[model samples]
Target: MPWAVLRLHRAALAVWGAFLLATIGMLVWEAGINADSVRDRIAACGHDPGLCRIRAVVDYGGTIGWASTLVYYSFFAVAAFAGGALIGRELENGTAQLAWTQSVSPTRWLAATLAVPAVLLVAGGTVFVFVFRWAWAANRDLMGDDWTFNDVFAARGPALVAYGLCALGVGALAGVVLRRSLPALGVACGVMYLINHNLEKSREDLWPTVASGGSGGQFHPESHYWPMHLVETGIVLGVAVVATGAAFWVLRRRTG
Candidate 1:
């Protein structure tokens, strides 16, 4: 059972980590070639060529974008798939019941299963932050030193760390509600993707839902990126807390 959980989460991490590493390679190539073209474009626009935002965004294989994307993607990869399929399948297949009847308690068993994926998820988040920081520092103008550490690093990195940890909680809840893996996967994946996608799409507004901005200057940069992070962090904390509570409830209610 422990081996089953390890294979499930680690495999997912390997798959996603490959993508992240490949993205890094791609960034190095772009920094050498494409960055110059971006520099030209910024110059043409009368913006300072050295401080090209586009190049910065691309530098380090898009560390900023990758930093942000990895958090969401890792959550889905581990939380949605591993929890949805492997662990979910165990319960659905009555394997959990068989294990529970043995010497080990349910809570201990569940905790062990969760450990593999939890470690992988956190590892991924840390790798992304490290890679992004390396890239961001190399191209300060793109990331803009004016940005808060919270905005660039802490927000996405820590939020994702929390999010990946929270996924186990969601899995616990799903385990209690649906005795099968596929249905649980569907519900968790559908909800996670929908919330992440819709909220980010309408980034000018709060996520979990979106809205346009309030009255402000025509070029009000203030109404844009900063507030968006604040809202996003709030949502992350809210969901993490709820998911965690639900997981504990499932364990206690089930006496495992």
Candidate 2:
């Protein structure tokens, strides 16, 4: 059993989890204490009688929620570092072939290794989502004319998980094909970052929609369906799965 994967995943969560919690706690606390200022700001922005209201408005509620989501995304970086090191380091030390020589087949090895970090990712996501829902519920109506917690939490949350999975897949693929861990780590990290760049570019910039007919009118950014974000996220997860399968097939064939 490649215990390295489990260790890597735990380390990623232990280290990154603390950071994520700290950031969220502070923001939530800030929001709670500063509710008055936040409310005033929201009222000010909402009362504006302007032409073509803006979408990217940040209110206290949005601020609290945004802070949580931003910290949640920091998981991607943690996953890249830990996931890359998982197989990449083994391949670097030239000990990865040792797996093939052992009774454990390549497929089993992949499953065991991948499971470790996958659990960590899920745990982290679960915590984030729970906290996000709470924060959103608390601040929902007070969220402001142009800000939204849904935008901050839902869309970006899944994307972060997909990114982590892709990073691990990158490491595995590199190990199987190149048999060198450091190079694999570098390549995987770089490629995932590049993909993330594109994901960001294509990411829909959504905000609350303006409430119509009212004298002052409610305003929000052009909101999007949260489920639609699954499309790109699924695409990323698909690439990671394909790459992983190919790596396993190639490695097993080589071993046999």
Cα lDDT tens digits, model 2, 18-135, are 8767765765675466666655554565557242122223445456656655654553464356335666566566555687587766678777877776677666666665665566
The lowest-lDDT stretch of 10 consecutive residues in candidate 2 is 49-58
The per-model lDDT (C-alpha) reads 0.60, 0.60
lDDT per residue for candidate 1 within 1-256, as digits (tens), equals: 5686666556665776787677556556454456566556666756454455455445533545554554446566655664576567877787777888987677777767766666666776667656555655565544544333333533334555665665655755675577677777777766666656665565544523333469533332433544657666567667867875676567668663
Off by over 4 Å in 1: 1-4, 7-10, 28-71, 140-156, 197-231
lDDT of 1: 0.60
What are the models' TM-scores?
A: 0.66, 0.68
Clashes of each: 2, 7
**How far in Å is the alpha carbon of 156 misplaced in model 1?**
5.2
